[model samples]
Target: MQATTPLSANSAATAPRTAQPVAARGRLITDAPTRMFHWLFALSFVGAYLTAEGERWRMLHVTLGYTMAGLLAFRVLYGLFGPRQAGLGLLWRKLGSAPAWLKSLRTAGSLTAVNWRQGQNLLMALAVVALLVMVLPLTLSGYATFNEWGVFPGEDWLAELHEFFGEAMLFVVLGHLALIGGLSVLRRKNQAAPMLTGRVDGPGPSLVPHNRRWLAALLLLAVLAYGAWEWQQSPKGLVPANAWSQVPGGEASGGDDD
Candidate 1:
């Protein structure tokens, strides 16, 4: 048989073919405000805890509290109006459910739901609840102490309770930070960085445009400022009259001057 002529060097090039660009890996997850609120709240909570009693520091602490409250309120609104991936409903819907692939009766396949981190998610949720529980009392008590309301005869009990919750919150926060750090290191994932950039990897819905987020953030700032201004201007916020001074023969023994 005659030796087959060697195929031309350009033969493969002439053959029909198709080329498609590979899709980019990773996608955005967290929104801008969500990220900003995370870090800012983290810092403010730490500051408030450390300088809780000092006069000048209390100003910063109070301002930060109002800011944190505003951020939390904004998060609620954003969850409703923002992207699906960042929305509260989406995040929590499948949370308590078994993984879709693993819910079937078929035993022939590996269980996909087996690896779901329900414990971790629950832990995070608990931390959030604890933070809120602690903060509510702490914030209200701070306001009470500020107003000098002396609702319970002496504000000492309220003040102590507020401090107790505040400290408790700090402990939980430290745990949260530790979890993030550990997860990042173990998975080689930058969990902390996402809060700064408000972006995340993996499949997710489209991000809200920066412009919209900016407007939302501005409104948040306005509300926060209003809260702070109100706190400062409210007459009840002045330090309370000392109990000893108000008592018989105890004049000059207690009060702000003391």
Candidate 2:
């Protein structure tokens, strides 16, 4: 190196001058409505489940169930009219894409790239389906018992069917929790915090899409109103030996005794 040389502009530019990190995008992951629904649903489900058998807790259980039903119904409407990413059409399309990808994988053809969002999208769609199934019977059976519409005509299957679906929901909910825990650990992320705080920190390396706000607000309002109305008609009026209550006898008293 006999001659001192000025650095070439290209080389100088290419050199790693102190690495400057990019600022994170605005905190725009989950909106307030979405986050509120998440926690309320969690609380309602747990309270309802724990209070299932006790008369003292029966009112609370019914109230919570009504709240859950209203929330779910509102969610369905919101998903339809919500933000682009939160729309039902987009979510369902993502779910449908999974089967197509699986088929393509079997065919040995060059497959289109599927992003991380696909996995989360599919999981969410499945959870939605599971929830819908669970809620339909829970709500229907509850109404049936309350209104004295026993067996529901030819749909006598509803009684047993409701019990089965309700129990099945427990498994689906557990699976959801496991999936969340696993994803968070694997990605080194705090996925649950966003639902709690209504804001995600960084766009980190994940496919969790953002939610819309207006639709979420509408949903929350609708659910809260419906829940308040339903809670006012708590199941106490229909209390008896029905499955919801603990009748003085070992067995529930209302069903036909043959």
TM-scores for every candidate against the unseen true structure: 0.63, 0.63
Expressed as tens digits, the lDDT of each residue in 1-258 for candidate 1 is 888888786997798878887775455556666666566667767767766876744655676666666666666777789767567775455544434424542553554634435545555655665665566677877778667666566448767877777877888988977877877886798767766655567676646444256754776577567756866885544233453465588767532553
* Model 2 Cα lDDT, one tens digit per residue, 174-240: 8888877877887788666767765566555433355545655766677667666665675543233
Model 1 residue pairs with clashes: 147-236
Q: Judging by TM-score against the true structure, name the best candidate.
A: 2
Model 2 misses residue 72 by how many Å? Answer: 1.7
lDDT of 1: 0.65
* TM-score attained by model 2: 0.63
Off by over 4 Å in 1: 1-25, 90-116, 151-155, 202-211, 216-258
RMSD of model 2 against the true structure: 10.8
| Per-prediction tally of clashes | 1, 0
